[model samples]
Target chain A: GESVGLHLPTLSVQEGDNSIINCAYSNSASDYFIWYKQESGKGPQFIIDIRSNMDKRQGQRVTVLLNKTVKHLSLQIAATQPGDSAVYFCAENAGSQGNLIFGKGTKLSVKP
Target chain B: GAGVSQSPSNKVTEKGKDVELRCDPISGHTALYWYRQSLGQGLEFLIYFQGNSAPDKSGLPSDRFSAERTGGSVSTLTIQRTQQEDSAVYLCASSQVGGIQPQHFGDGTRLSIL
Candidate 1:
């Protein structure tokens, strides 16, 4: 198992502002990256994903940026909303083994 | 259901009791995974099942923990002689047919060992 870490444990933002949650991974061989948002007492919901070949991938209101060089990944949420508040986690897959190494996660709090 | 489903949303048992947790994956999905999340901690890989072949039980914490998938549709995770440290949320997830695909998770079964 590889170590996936987060730079921050918590982030608070106001409405309409952009939010950036950073993650650092140790497995350089990881080829796939994904971001998941989990609400209280619920399972993780897929937000966005990016392959190692590409540096960035975007989805509605969210974007995932990967830096293979530094083994770092970040999820950016545009126009933060109250509904966007949750714990975000970054997961990485080294290959086709189907095992995703997960980070400890960062709690995102969006203010109304 | 459109997403993965798990049974026994909450379980409380005495120490040394054996319990089973069941999971019903989405139809036609051949890949299933089980993970454990401790309090204030991240998800920990437990076991993975692909199709009908031998499951990858490397992530299992000890011999007391085991899992099985029947017909590649439903899965059951059993704990033998439950311990106090075994208290945690057990989550089950399913993916298309390969590891590269995204995984859909269930609400998870909250197991409390008293």
Candidate 2:
């Protein structure tokens, strides 16, 4: 079965430092990927997304790198802040209807 | 106010009872999705709806779980004969279009089977 998974369960970083979370997916046909941030008691919020055609995509303070050859994906956050402390999830669109398969999240803790 | 909406922020019900969760996608969104999140775990895809097409219920956990989308807008996920293991957060999300679009999510309904 096709699945998406994270490399780490938790990542702790100091404020003003950079953070990188990694994910591995098993589906070769998946063409779309997304990164979401979920705070305590909140839904997963969309952070950034990248299509298979692009190797990298950048948002305001975040970047998503997709390596289809190795089926690896990563989310990079610059100058991590307390507000950025949350569970980060990586998802791949595995179906034609746009259903997503999400990886077990990586809890990001930014220490001030 | 423009994001997806779900009703009953939390629900506590005894085992064997049936409960319904609601989701209202963003206006004009063509795609809607439901997912479940167990405590400290990741999201699991439950179902998907796009436009007027038939829903994809491939991810539904069991026969006790079912869903319906009315008029391509509001959706209801019904769980019958709920079990203790059904306790989780049910999340709803919508995308402006179907393929490759970023989905916006709503605060989920926390269903606790006591």
Candidate 3:
């Protein structure tokens, strides 16, 4: 079955350092990918998204890179702060079907 | 000015009981989705509604789970004879249109079946 999976389940990063979360997707048909930040006891919030046509997309201090050839996706946070600590999930929209498959999130812990 | 909203922020019921969860999508939004998330797990697509068309129920886990969107606005998810394994957080999200667009999510309803 096609699925989106993450390389790490948990990551600990020091404040002001850069953080990278990786995701691997099996669905080659996916044309759009999105990154979401979910805090404890809250719903997933959209952070940034990139289309298959673009290799990278930037928003605020976050950037999403898509490597279609390798079927890999990544989210990079610059100058990571304590507020940026949350479970980050990568989701892929295979098509216009509105079905988004999400990867098992990476829990990011930023230490001050 | 408002985001998606779900009712019964928390629900606790015994096994074999039935439960209904409601989701109120943002006004004028035509697409709504339901997803389930277990502890320490990722989001699981449950069902999706696009306008007044038939919903894509392929993601529904089993016959015990069902959902419906009325008038292209609100939606309700029903779980029958729920079991302990059904415990999880049910999230509802709405988008201006279906597919490729960013979705605004509700706080979600946490269901605990004991």
DockQ, each predicted model: 0.78, 0.85, 0.82
Position B104, candidate 2: lDDT: 93
Better of 1 and 3 by TM-score: 1
lDDT of 2 by residue, B2-113 (tens): 8899999999999999999999999999899999999999999998888655468889999999888888899899999999999999999999888789989999999999
* TM-score list, all predictions: 0.98, 0.97, 0.97
Ranking by TM-score: 1, 2, 3
Ranking by DockQ: 2, 3, 1
How good is the docking of model 3, as DockQ?
0.82
lDDT of 3 by residue, A1-112 (tens): 7799999999999999999999999999889999999999999999998889999899999999999999999999999999999999999985686678999899999999
List the lowest-lDDT window of 10 residues for candidate 2 chain B.
B48-57
lDDT of 1 at B79: 99
The CAPRI quality class of candidate 2 comes to high
DockQ of candidate 1, scored on C-alphas against the true complex (2 decimals): 0.78
Cα lDDT for residue B25, model 1?
Answer: 92
For residues A6-107, what per-residue lDDT tens digits would candidate 2 score against the true structure? 999999999999999999999999999999999998999999999999999999999999999999999999999999999999999977778899999999
- Model 1 chain A scores worst on lDDT over the 10 consecutive residues at A93-102
Local accuracy of candidate 3 as per-residue lDDT tens digits, B1-114: 498999899999999999999999999999999999999999999988998664588889999998988899989999999999999999999999998898889999999999
Q: Is the docking of candidate 1 incorrect, acceptable, medium or high quality?
A: medium
